[model samples]
Target: MFDIKQYLQEQRQLVEEALRQYMLAAEGDFAAHIETMRYSLFVGGKRIRPILCLTAARCVSDEPDVDMLLLPAACALECIHTYSLIHDDLPAMDNDDLRRGQLTCHKKFGEAEAILAGDGLLTYAFELISSEQFLGLSLEVRLRLIAVLARAAGSLGMVGGQFLDIASEGKEIPFALLKTIHRSKTGALITAAVQMGAIGGGAVAAQLQALTEYGGAVGLAFQIVDDLLDVTSSSKQLGKTAGHDAGQGKATYPAFFGVEKTRALAIEAAERAVAALVGFDERANPLRALARYIVSRTN
Candidate 1:
């Protein structure tokens, strides 16, 4: 049988090693700033975005060292993800005290330092994506990848969704609005991760289209699970403050559909995610399993 747990652990370790090698050191004249940036980036998490990016690249590419070729892009994704998490936990946002079972960046390093750290990571992501070291990948491909990531993580995507979320706080938002927020805030980056991998691996239009569909479904499902976890799990289990959705009066699947219906919706989304991979064979099995894994994850 295919062991998803083992596969996840192995991939996670690969991502961990790559991150350590690619990350900046906290040893320069700007040591404290770099340390603050490294603080949250090195903190324990599943490293799902980078892993998904690399796996998507492998699925599309026949190159033996696709992982090496795509390591920079994978690292970029992680940096962007880490930056979002750092800002999300700030007092102005979620106001959470913990993340990945450690103090939030703002709490650990103070607000100003944390803000700069987030800014540093966000800018560094694009820098890594366009670095001269990744010159082997054609200029066109790198530009495309950078453009895709920019649109996803920029004001028109993740940031826009966050703005809508904070604006709608303490008010009853319609289900459609909530979905818009989730799709932009959470789903966009996840889609970008897979799309970036596909672009790096030289995917054609059709293959990219299929993977985009798959990513969209999986990303939405991920947010649905997060909504469920906010109500059903504890901070100790999630490694961050839970129940924030309800406390903030934010709209969620559970808020509109109840837990059982929300669970059913999550399963449906996962099923759609797997169905989108119909064109691929066993090579895409990891993506298929990941769909189910998202709903079943504890945190």
Candidate 2:
């Protein structure tokens, strides 16, 4: 049996180690600012984005130390993810007090510091990906990776989705628009994680296309499951404020479809994600398992 739990733990360790090595040290004149960034970055989380990047690379390449080769890109994905979380928990956004079971960056470090920390992480992600450390990839490939990440994290993607989500609060929105919000806000970065791995691993066009499809399905499943958890789970279980979406009047899968229907949708998306991997061999088993895991995750 492919033990998904063990696989997640091992991959998460690799991601955490890489993050520690590549992240800026909180010292010197800017110690205060950097410390806030480190505080949020080092706080506990699933580390799913970076793990997806590494696993997607493994699916395409059997090269020696392929995970090591893609560490910079993987770490960059995590940085961007962490930065988003920090900003999301700000008073102007979700206004949550807890994240990953710890005080939010803004709550612990003040609003201005949290904003700067988010900004620092966002900019540092690009710096890491563009730096000389991400060796083995050609200049063209590197540029492509950068572009993919930028588009996913920028206004057209996550930012745009967030704007739409906030705007739609307290208003009943069509299901189609809700999907658009989810796809841009949550799905784009998740898909980009897989795409970056494929590009870095030298996947051919067909392989990239298949992986992209898989990424899209997985992203949809992930957001749906999140919506379900928001309604079904507790804040303690989520390590953050649960039911905040309902309180904020945010449109969600559960809001459109009941709990059971929303859960069914999540399963359907996971199935589609798995179907997209039919072209790959056993190397893609992790991706398949991850798709299933996304829908089943409790937090």
- TM-score for model 1? 0.98
Query: Where is the poorest 10-residue window by lDDT in model 1?
Result: 129-138
Q: Report each candidate's C-alpha RMSD, comma-separated, in the order given.
A: 0.9, 0.8
Residue 271, model 2: lDDT of 98
Q: Largest lDDT belongs to which candidate?
A: 2
lDDT of 1 by residue, 1-299 (tens): 67888998998888888778877888979999999999999998888888888878888888978878888888898899999999988899989899989999999999999999999999999999888878768899999999999999998889999999999999988888999999999999999999998899888899899999989999999999999999999998999888988898899999999999999999999999999889987878888898899899999
Candidate 1 yields a Cα-based lDDT of: 0.90
The sequence of per-residue lDDT tens digits that candidate 2 reaches over residues 1-299 is 89999999999999899999999998899999999989998998898989988899999998967878889889889889999999988889889999988999999999999999999999999999899877778899889989999999999999899889889999999999999999999999999999999988889999999999999999999999999999999999999899989999999999899999999999999999999999999999999999999999999
Q: Report the Cα lDDT for candidate 2.
A: 0.93
**Best model number under TM-score:** 2
State residue 40's C-alpha deviation in candidate 1, in Å. 0.2
Clashing pairs in 2: none
Q: After best superposition, candidate 2 residue 2: deviation in angstroms? A: 0.4
As a whole number from 0 to 100, the lDDT of residue 8 in candidate 1 is 89
